[model samples]
Target: MTEKPAKLLPPNPTIGVFDSGFGGLTVLRDLLPLIPGARYIYLGDTARLPYGSKSRETIARYAVSSAKFLEEQGADLLCIACNTASALALEDIKQAMPIPVVGVIQPGAEAALATSEASPSTPKSVLVLATTATTQSHAYAQSLNALGLAATEKACPLLVPLVEEGWIDHHVTAEVLRIYLNEAFAEAPNAQTLLLGCTHYPLLQPLIERTLAELNHPMTIIDSAAATAADVAAYFPPNPNGAPATSRFYATDSIEKFQRLGSAFLNQPVSEVHLLDLGG
Candidate 1:
């Protein structure tokens, strides 16, 4: 009698992704294709956005609540897609959660390090553009230095609000970006790489690129959200071999607005967004 070969079942677990607002959708945009078979539960806490200015205690509380909600929703793994939250709340969230929680900062730091390798000399000065919280935390700079790279970080607190308002091409946005970029250049003139330390900043990439061009500076701008997605792909377990193909979107407020703004970030229809009361 011949023995039958075992069949492989798809991974039933869903990956939970969180952000303070729509910014994290950019992370999801880059993530989905890489893990096409895995199910994703994306939650955007639009109700309490702009976590950048919030106190550490508040941000940590919100992060823990968000993670608990996701876990209740059957998340096997979690990714904190918000740079501000990742900067301020990652440690507390990790401690509060039973499952693995990844943050955007470390993955982005890894990507920037990889890019810096192109010019190994001078210890590779790098610039990080991020929210006030991220800049204040010095997460990118510390991570880069830990990896033996000289890093400069600047706070672009206004960038995310502008991006969320769908003002990427606005002249004001360009001017604001120029001001922040100038600060970065002044701090580290030899910087050959610019890390878009916040997910929302990628929406302004073209303008940022143009501003850099005008300065006659040709530095690589790393999109941290995209890099985070790459790291998530690498983190997924291979034993499952396959996973569910569906993705679900949830928001703490205005599912309609999320869908509308999400198109710009995800470059796809977010017609399936479901509203969440979150029982505040």
Candidate 2:
């Protein structure tokens, strides 16, 4: 008699998203509606955050540790939502995790490229607004250039702090955005694409758009957080039934603060944030 074949089980569809702090919640926010069937595990390395200041080796070590913890939690896929980590530690995290990994930088760059290419009459230049570390790394520039598009990256260090302070619509924030856009436009006058390179910058999108309009420079703005979520969603099978997504939050420090800030970024109440210790 012929033996029956062993039954094959489908892989778990849990996704792990990592960032140095609450800024990554914006990425998670966009991901929820797009891939509602998958469960999400979000980890914010708040204890050793501001990964922008750390050396690349240190960032890699921290990111790898976080990735390993998520892997232990049975994550089938990983999304590096921190621009700094995506710039410096993406490869390390990918190697350390036993799952498919996606980073924000590539998706953002691809979006800019697509936008620029779609309007051939417009200049083939992209302007990237990011944190000091990401701009210094030239990750966006390199990624765009690889696609044959010219990129100019401006480091807006103050934007992160202002956004964190919940000053998204304040006049001060608008003025700051105006100044930054003026400087960026001066550097890349013909840029037709504006890529928000830092996760936190999405909170300031309206202000950035207004500032660009005031400057008389109309350009397509690419929110990397949203683009990253869209790209990640493409990797999963569609949820035709529109199921609700379940999410768990973890932080290396200050669960209360994580919930408070994360809720703001997510535009929804963030509850039951578990504390995690990744060590010094």
Candidate 3:
């Protein structure tokens, strides 16, 4: 495994990104444009996914292993793109790994704070849309509150399946999101920022904006994938003339499904996903 360099990053650092499944590709998608001349190693632990259902200890073990695997592949930085893993096992992974590990919660909260400050007229409140486990974890609330921004976490349990099923613009999906947003808005009318707590939500950003306009409530939308990418981007200076990024994707299981769905998540073709077996 590569050791953390004394400095933050090299000229063209290798970055590791991991999620339980295909959703993490969204983070990688955002990263390519932000940090040019970089290498990305993405892992979809498809064989043992839905880390939300596992115990905290188990989640930590799995996430740490994934981080180590990426490190072994020459990653200097790691992004735990999964909300459940970020909520449940971030510290464990950070402690075990030799590199910097940035999770979605802090970046989202900080971005909300920055955006809220930019708009003095709006309330310093954030509405987070995430999975039930993430909402119950209250990780976003704690992070936001620490920065003097109030947070309301709404668990959109149906959104993940809807997203995975490629229903980004379907009417039923829109209705479900509309209901969730309305319910969340009812809870926090003052929320000025909508934080996407789930990486899968970036694909639904267009539809989310439409729904907000339909409800006559237009809040600044924050994609954590973008936020996390920006956070990682801070490690290096802008280099417009840098070389194009190269990527390698590995899936623990279902390479075909990962390649199929990963294309949509990445908004680009995904080919030659290597199969990796991390023992259970």
How many clashing pairs per prediction, in order? Answer: 0, 0, 0
Candidate 3 residues lying further than 4 Å off, grouped into runs, are: 1-6
Cα lDDT over the full model 3: 0.90
Q: Which ten residues in a row have the lowest lDDT in candidate 3?
A: 1-10
| C-alpha lDDT (0 to 100) for residue 33 of candidate 3 | 86
Best by TM-score: 3
lDDT of 2: 0.87
Candidate 3 Cα RMSD after full superposition onto the native fold (Å): 2.8
lDDT of each: 0.82, 0.87, 0.90
Model 1: runs farther than 4 Å from truth?
A: 1-13, 237-244
RMSD of each: 6.0, 5.6, 2.8
Per-residue error (Å), model 3, residue 88? 1.0
User: Higher-TM-score candidate among 1 and 2?
Assistant: 2
Arranged by TM-score, best first: 3, 2, 1
- Find the candidate with the highest lDDT and give its number: 3
Which structure is stronger by lDDT: 1 or 3? Answer: 3
Give the per-residue lDDT of model 2 (tens digit) for 1-280. Answer: 0112133112237889999999999999999888766789999999998898899999999999999998889887788999999999998987777677889999998888778778888888889999999999999999999889999999999999898888999999998888888898888898888999999999988888888788788889999999899887777666667568889999999888888788889999997999999998
- Tens-place lDDT digits, model 3, residues 56-110: 9998998898999999999988989999998999989989998888887888888
Q: Considering only N, C-alpha and C atoms within 3 Å, which residue pairs clash in candidate 1? A: none
| TM-scores, all models, native as reference | 0.90, 0.95, 0.96
